[model samples]
Structures are given as structure tokens and as C-alpha cells.
Target: MDIFEFYKKMDADDIMLSFKGSVTSELLTSVLQIIEAKMERLNEPSKIKKKVYNVLVESLQNLYHHMDKNEQDIKGHSTVIFMIGNNAKAYSIYTGNYVRNENAEKLQAKLEKINSLNPDELKAYYKEVLNNGMMSDKGGGGLGMIDIARKSGQKLNFRFQQVDNEFSFYSLNINIAKQ
Candidate 1:
């Protein structure tokens, strides 16, 4: 591996933080700390920092709580890839993890529905889902994605790549403006 090449790539892409490993509560906390410190050192504006931090928390939690079953179908390996980027206009967060193929369709549909709504509609939909009180086994009441969208005021960019018959990789990208 060319270390310098990787370094240059990260620099070119404006990636502030990048990690690929098993998702756990401990790692999540550490990542949060690291990102918070980085932003502080850069003297990031309070508004943008809070927005990035909030979105990061939800994205990491989603990975920790809902990533595909531990025993991955892909060579028995399970991991999540997460990155945070900083550019002139915005801060970007990206996360990727293995998901069971069977669940891919439902997730895609849900994401599409979320993307289809306008800001006001998103707020209303968020309230509707919150009021319904229907939660999943992981304690999510289907509010995380909506909250991310509402808080960022941007559409969620997501894609699913088929890995094999049993699994697909789901990737999500979110951006929060510096202004």
C-alpha cells in the first residue's frame, strides 16, 4: 500500500476523519470526541459544529444498532466504513455497512419516501411517526432518518450495492452547511 497516495487522496477529498471497523458504543464515543476536537481546533462556527455533531450521532447510532447481523455473509467479516469531510461550503458525513439483501428493498423504499417530502412535510411526517409510537426492536421509532433530514435541511443521499446473494452494502451521505 502507498501511504503517501492514501494521504494525498484524503487531502484531495477533504476527508477530515475516516474509519473502517466493527461498530460499537465505545468506538462511537471515541469518534465523537475526535471529531469534536478537530472541529474545535479548526474554530468551526457553533451552528455548523452542532449540526455536524448531531447528524454524526444519529448516523453512528444507526450503524451500531442496526448494521447487518454480526455473522456477516461476506467471509464472516463485519465492519462499517465512516468518514467526515470538510470543504468550503459544507461538512459531509458518509457511512457504509453491510446489510442483509432481504432488507435492502425496504430500506431503499423508506429512504426514497423520506427524500420525496418537502421541509414542512418532513416535519409533519416526523411528528406523525413520533406520535404513532411504533418502534423497532432496536428502539428506533423510525425517527432518526427524518430527524437527520429535518435537522440538516437536505435530502439524504443513499445507495445500495449488492455484495452477494445474501448481503448488500448500504451507504449514506449527509451534509451540513457551514453557514
Candidate 2:
């Protein structure tokens, strides 16, 4: 969709909660609590709740670790925004954070690779990477995109917004069905 349409839909959706700040462990916990409470209020089934919870955790952790921060200031923290919403067909989770320009190209390539695969191919590729790829200190093992795609059962949607010469804002969207 075009940027205008995307923004319009976001504005129309019933945003249960939206958080923007440094993604520390404490902030992550608070965000999870808010999301869980919203899911509870919606009377979502346990199976759906589990899926949503897992996806949320992984997404937040990805942001906490991979997001780029300003280098000029020693105390500058990465900016992250998380939003949860539902439409007639699916529940949507969106995350936005800054990423270095160099990392943006790499991230785009990774996402494109994931988006190109079917379920079977994605599973096979994920296995291949898990078995052969070097793991980061966080133990990501290049699997976050695959995991998000597998759990959401949908193609990941992403975009990069230029912030300056050195970095851009990266936004990713994952959707899960109501059923």
C-alpha cells in the first residue's frame, strides 16, 4: 500500500496500546503486560495468545539489540515504537526503529530472502541457517525473520525511512489471523 493508505489504516485501527522509548528490559516487561491485558480483554483463546506473545517477545528483543543508536552522544538510546491492532481479518503488530544505513541494505536483503520463500522453503532455509550460520552474542543465529514469518503465517512487510546520511528508520509489520 502507499504510505498515505498505510497511515490512514493505522489511524483508523483501534490501537490497544502504543509505546515509544528506549527498549530496555523494564520497558519490554511493561509493554508485554499491556499487550497481555489487551489480549485478555479481547477474550483471545490461549492458542492465539501464545502465538502473539511469542511474536511480540521476539520482535521486541530484536529491536532492543539490533536497532541503531546515535553515536555522537554516549547516552543516546535507540528509538523504538510498538503498536498492536486488529482488523476484520487479522491482528497486526508493528515495530519501528533506527538502523544504520549500512545495516539497512543487509536487512533488506535478508527480509527479501525470507519473503521469497514458501512455507516449506522457509522451513528448509531456516534449518540450513540454524545449522550453519554463526550465532550472534544474543544467539539469534539469523532466525528472527524466519521465526516471525513462520509464526505470523504471513509475509513480513517492511520499509526504510531516511533519517539522515548515516541511518534510516526501519519499520516492520507482522499480521496474525483472528482464527
Candidate 3:
């Protein structure tokens, strides 16, 4: 990768943190801590910081658990990308990883449903899902996306690009306002 171009882009976007590689629990923890510290230094309000941190935890954990688990190499590596940035209006978090083509349609539909809900409807849906005790092998009852929507108060921007007959790249972008 062109390091200088990457650096310039990040600088221009006001990115606070970024990572592209495998996600391990240890690395996730360190990333969270680093971002928390950076936000503190930046004088971000505690409320915004907490919201950002909570949504981030869910986001990263989802990556760790629900991504293309079979794509890992002998080194336990899978390709993933994450970025966090801020501008005058908001803080933005982005994550991209591969998903099996079979799973992509389900994920797309779920995100669309979540995006369709209003805040109150989202809370009701969240509660309903929580109460149902239904969870996937990844231990998610579809609450992560809902929670991301509720916390961000913004529609999740996502895309799925076919990589082959078997897999597609999934990208999610979330923005949290300063207000």
C-alpha cells in the first residue's frame, strides 16, 4: 500500500484511528483503549465518547465473531478493515470484511429492516429480539445492528460487492453526531 497516500487521506479526513488486518480479542481491547485515550485527549464530551465506545465494542466484536470465519489462514488471519474519524458534524466509524455470498442477502435484508425503523420502533424491536432469546452461532440475536442504529441515530450505510461465487465484501459506515 502507498503509505504516504494513505496518511494524507487519513489526515484529510480527520481520522483518529485505523486498522486493517485480523481482529483478535487482545488487539480489539488495545484498539478500544487507544481510541478512548485519543478521544479524551481531544476533549470529546463524555457522553459522545461513551456512545462511540459502546458502539465500537459491538462493531468490533461483530467483526471478530460473524465475519468469514473460514477464510482464516494457518496463522489465524482474515482480512478486515476498520476506521474511526471525526469532522465538524460527527464521528464516523467504518468496517469492512468479507462474508459468504450465502450470508450476504440475509445481512442486507436485516440492515434494511433496521434502517427502516424509527427510534421508538427500533427500541421496541430491540426489546423483542432480546426477549426472544434467539441467537445465531455467533451469539448475536441481531441486536448489534439495531444497537448501532439506535446509538448512531443514523441509517447504516452498507454495501456488498461480489468477490466470487462464494464470497462478497461487506462494508458498513456509521456516523454519530456531536450533538
What would the per-residue lDDT of candidate 1 be over residues 43-76, giving only the tens digit for each residue? 9988888999999999999888765435444454
The number of the candidate with the highest TM-score is: 1
Tens digit of per-residue lDDT, candidate 2, span 87-166? 66777889998777888899999999999999999999889989998987764777888998998888999999887887
lDDT of each: 0.88, 0.82, 0.87
Off by over 4 Å in 3: 71-77
Q: Residue 2 CA error for candidate 2 (Å)? A: 25
Query: Model 3, residue 26: displacement in angstroms?
Result: 0.4
| lDDT over C-alpha atoms for residue 136 of model 1 | 75
lDDT of 3: 0.87
Give the C-alpha miss distance for residue 5 in model 3, angstroms.
1.8
Q: Give the runs in model 2 whose Cα sits over 4 Å from its true position.
A: 1-11, 67-77
lDDT of 3 by residue, 67-108 (tens): 445555222326789999889888899999887787899999
Deviating ranges (above 4 Å) for candidate 1:
68-77
Worst 10 residues of 1 by lDDT: 68-77
Among the numbered candidates, top lDDT falls to 1
As for TM-score, the candidate ahead, 1 or 3, is: 1
